[model samples]
Target: MLPFENIILIDKKSSIAVYKQIANSIINTVRNGVLKPGTKLPGSREMASILNVHRKTVIASYDELEAQGWITVFPRKYVMVAEKLPLLHPKKWDETELAYSYDNDLKINFRIIDKSWCVERDTVEIIIDDGHPDVRLSPIDELLKTYRSFTSRQPAIKSANKGTAQGTVRLREEMVKFLSITRGLTINTDNILITHGAQMSIYLAAQLLLNTQSTIIVGKPNYTVANETFIQTGTQLIEVSVDEYGINTDQIEQLCKKKKITAVYVIPHHHYPTTVTLSVERRMKLLELSNRYSFVIIEDDYDYDYHYASSPYLPLASANHQGNVIYIGSFSKLLDPSLRIGFMAAPKNFIVQCTALRKMIDVGGDGYMQNALAELIKTGELKRHLNKTKKIYHNRRDFLNDLLQSQLSEYISFTVPNGGMAVWITLRKDYSVKQLQNTPLLKIIRTDEESNSFRLGFASMNEQEIEITIDLLHNLLKKQ
Candidate 1:
């Protein structure tokens, strides 16, 4: 007999009964061919003494093994391995099978798509991102307190686990009230669906609306991620030029006349890459075109709350009477991007479809965080934070603009934006982004080739960092 002590080691702390553990160990040994058929096992009394388990425990293990056809028990005499074990099919091993490489058999059919937008910099110290918010301003303590409070309550914990994909009812209700007062929209909780972020909302919208036969009208230098999302849906993208006054609506109307456009994706408030607000005249024209062409208008007002100069334009959804607009917004800009909280506002039927699709992908959003945000909104903490950040961002924006004009006037030309986080600086045609990126002093900033612009985000940086970044850019430009 193989030493029973070496074969079966019982764990007293395990939740599994001692007898079951012994039975499982013996079964595993049998399956592994460590114990051959017809091999005799120790008597229960001797096994119990060797294993340091109760004699009854050893008897129960032997009984279980016999019941499962792993062993046969002779009448009060001995326990032997069964001639044929349960659920075991012994196959002869072929040495030739080991010669084949899995690499050829396990091949990936899909092509890898690169979605990297930011260049990796190892030595760069200052980072000028694409209009990201300062997470230092986040009320982490208050949020944690609210989260702890919710988790401490049994009812809240239970409700969180059973939350709907459309998000918690309380958060939805709070969102309805918040959007109504801030964006001047008359909407209820039924018209809203909370999403992971604006990116997820864009993807869900694209999935519901577009097909291979559909055409999506977008700005020439639009949000790259949104453009990629539409592309992944197998839809044709018709790029219209975006100037100082936003996407050319006249061109969009011309496309509408030629083809049956499915949707028009626009960042009308502050166009990505170029922080130019859509002219009021063009906004009206786009709305009229959407109504006439029967195309869905995807208005991505991502950073709507970060306006500095003047009152921001009301979202297209607020004036959309024909129900052709699906407005997407995110609190990621106001809070932290990692929070991943965004909302989509559309017709109730559309929202219902989005909710169903969202359920298929994700069971629900973070209920605790959503509930905490709702509390912040209800108690005016979110509003106060926004107000405070707005002033700080506005100051930073102005300061960055002054530094750019004073230092980089010879090498770059830019228009000061009315109400966005970053200014769009156009490097002189002679200078290449590649050359700037190679320079050690200017590697921190990201330059876009699609728009011939550099989006220098000022909202996240302090005055000292901003000055240092500007000084570095000035020195780099002077070297050229």
Candidate 2:
């Protein structure tokens, strides 16, 4: 009565013998708990008629099954599964519901690394992110158009599988020229490795350069994700104090004298949590110390495009360090955070190793998307988009600063950042940032309870939205 015909598919043209194929299919069914122990199988003649195969083939398959201990064939009787075989109870075939329902609170047998620090908060109606770009302002349509064109072209279709682990040739070539003109980087395709995002590039650099015995220096209250990445490497993380002028190079030099420092992680352009640019003096000193102590500098210049006051400082990678700096940058800040496109510029030899390791984790990135982005860069559409967003973001930054100064001066205080999307706000001693975060309606993603501060992002919000957010904050403060 069981659907033996549907379950046992036959391929007459296969190199495998037809009888052996039928035998193997039945064995698999038993292993999968479908054909339970003691279950009755169709007679050889009946199965042959149902399967549209000759009775001799079905007889041979049943004999093979008996020899393999999968079934028992009684003389002048029906065929059935072996009586002594292990029982594998399967769900009833006529049941409508699933056999096993999934439970979110399932128990695990293995231990996992504690990643409590990286918490993904539930999104509310209004979210205040930590310096993210507005996706509405990105030139996504233009990029997608190019992507479609590439997919249709014969040349691109042919090269789809030929992309290198480093990146697509077109994107790398375009990046070489783009970085040279925009960031003043003197490099070729060989010096760059495209990654999923800035965090990925940071991870790749950290994994290759640091080990358990390694000592790396970072700014106190540095980028949380970067700190966590270094900590995961089991490296000794020495935190240097970050002042208005940026991370103290004097302390780094002292540490270098005390021990062999492996690398120094810096966010020179508008450092995270507290947006302070590294001064030209400290930049030079850090380079000098790297040359003196032979420690690598991991420069993360995430938001280098939105300088409102004046021209932003050139990245440390653009300097003359004799290949001591690993520069990381991201287009996510320029476009949208969801668009994960980041690149690393390093010495050719170092890049080769990073590319090899990156392949172990990610074989290759979205080749079509990379090629599309390359077209945008080549046609100056990316630059035009940046110019348009820069003006808008610059205005948003000032607007938020003015609103904070004029309305919320009594509750919070912060220095106006020259560049970057978020303003680092320090709360008064009487109030805690926790109070704002505990509210139901507003969601502030980045907060430091220790510093009694939070990063208020404004670039993603327009003037009206900013006013609405401020009003909500005003009500919360007034309630207190």
Tell me the tens digit of each residue's lDDT in model 1 across 161-251: 6555998888889999999899988889899998999999999999999989999999978888888889888899989999989999999
Regions more than 4 Å wrong, model 2: 1-111
Over 4 Å off in model 1, which ranges?
1-106, 116-123, 439-446
Number of the top-ranking candidate, with TM-score as the measure:
2
lDDT per residue for candidate 2 within 1-480, as digits (tens), equals: 778888898998999999999999998877766888899998988999999999999999999988878999987889998877644556688955432335234577764566876666685667888999888989999988988998999999766546558988889999999999989999999999999999999999999999999999999878988998988899999999999999999999999999999999999999987999999999999999999989999999899888989998999999988898999999999988988999999999999999999999999888888888999999999999999998999999989988998889999989999989999999899887888888888888788898899999899999999999888888888777
TM-score of each: 0.78, 0.80
Query: Model 1 clash pairs?
Result: none
- How many collisions between residues are there in candidate 1? 0
- Checking candidate 2 for backbone clashes, the offending pairs are none
CA lDDT of each prediction against the hidden true structure = 0.87, 0.90
Error of 1 at 126 (Å): 2.0
